[model samples]
Target: MVGLMSGILLAPSAATAQVSDGGTVRQLDQLSQCRAMTDDKERLACFDRASAAILASRAAGDLMVLDRKAVIARKQSRFGLAVPTSEMFGGGRADEVTDVRQLDSTIKTASAAKAYGRWNLELANGSVWQTVDALTFGPSKGDAITLKEAPLGGYRATIAGGRSILVKRIR
Candidate 1:
């Protein structure tokens, strides 16, 4: 550990990982440095000191090592697909909603229109949107539909160049 840490400290080459302090790995290259000392007594003392330092650092809450699996799972749970770095990466936590807009989904299965009555539409993403008011016009399978937040509350469903109705997402 000393030798590895020494080389990192000695060599200024950039490392891929950054610590919480915004500093890259900088430390002794390996324990060989202490071994290289000529006196056996001094070498033993040096090794003891390094061991104690490692333990002290651990006790001081100065180290955190995240395994690859933890990072992979964090990234997966955060980003939906492809994991675009521009929007989801870097030092920022992307938990903010940047816009209020329509939630679009493909109509997978739709209940038969009740002729001047409310109807039902099941989206591909498993959201069931049913009309709350009269639905004179209805959607068909494979139609791209959008549900936008209504002014007061609830949602309004509409298809491209089609009629819109007050719809609510049940599931």
Candidate 2:
């Protein structure tokens, strides 16, 4: 009875170990693809797609897919965005909130201020930390901000006045 109980107790742990191993493999594969990519933008894009795919898979509740996606997301976040940790890629940690806020601010400021041209909006602690080129009432007079296709994929930012910016998560 003692031996049987021990085996049962350990079973779950063993399964978990296997899952972790599988996830690691998937991440490595994605990283390999990113490295093999020739263009800088292409590499970043590959990482983003792989990361997003992983997130979507996890949302579907497939453990195997979740594990693989998690790993790939971590790798892509690290290599593409210089994010030091996987938590930066939506790992549900404390810092994840900060990332989300930053992304939100980037979208929000671009939309609200009617800023045109390239603007890098940084956010921290639910507030805009700094705005580089915060205002550019450039030649374009339309409320819409056009985004060109970035190397990673379609990269566009547009601001509708007096409204929240809709930011589509890349990955």
Candidate 3:
């Protein structure tokens, strides 16, 4: 009992644990302890220390806290790929769509570019993106590609030569 109490006392001011929610998990026990303090100055100091500790933990990658703005931005960034994202928006809101993500890749095989129709692209990142729309220009090997959200919840990828194509992430 003494060891546990001592450990708690020595622990950082603001502590958080991983939860299913997308927001930061706050430790209530430490917060309650600070509230128990009768002195106003001591309570304030305790809260300040806790806040600092929480910030440190976040910086250390020990915790993840995302706001609504971040969620919306990520959703926009990932428009065509079917990546599951339930916790990014928290509670998997009914109105929020969690089945899209953007992908950055490079042309691995130059043979796929020869076809004027659907061209398969093997990205340097190992994910594959294919052009869903008709392909006019052929992309050379090692072409830099950027896949981003397009209007109407579609994804468009632009190649190094400023040639754009409607692509879908297959992998």
Q: Rate the local accuracy (lDDT) of all candidates.
A: 0.54, 0.36, 0.59
Show the lowest summed lDDT stretch of 10 residues, model 3.
1-10
17-79 per-residue lDDT for model 1 (tens digits): 323243432212224466788999998987777566545444544433333344444443332
Q: Rank the candidates by lDDT, best first.
A: 3, 1, 2
lDDT string, candidate 3, 11-58, tens digits: 233333433254324543355578799999999998777667656765
Q: Whole-model lDDT, candidate 1?
A: 0.54
Model 1 scores a TM of: 0.43
- Angstrom error of the Cα, residue 97, model 1: value is 4.5
lDDT of 2 by residue, 1-171 (tens): 112211011123333432344344353356467879999999999988866655544454432322334444344333323234435333443234323211211233322333344333322212222122334442122333322223453233344333222223222
The alpha-carbon lDDT assigned to residue 59 of candidate 1 equals: 54
Alpha-carbon deviation at 166 in model 2, angstroms: 65
- Better TM-score candidate (1, 2): 1
TM-score of each: 0.43, 0.22, 0.48
Model 1: per-residue Cα lDDT at residue 126: 70
Query: After superposition on all CA atoms, what RMSD does each candidate show versus the true structure?
Result: 12.6, 18.0, 10.1
In model 3, which regions exceed 4 Å deviation?
1-79, 84-103, 110-116
Ordered by TM-score, highest first, the candidates read: 3, 1, 2
Clashing pairs in 3: 13-50, 14-50, 78-101, 78-102
Clashing pairs in 2: 111-159, 147-156
Count clashing residue pairs per candidate.
17, 2, 4
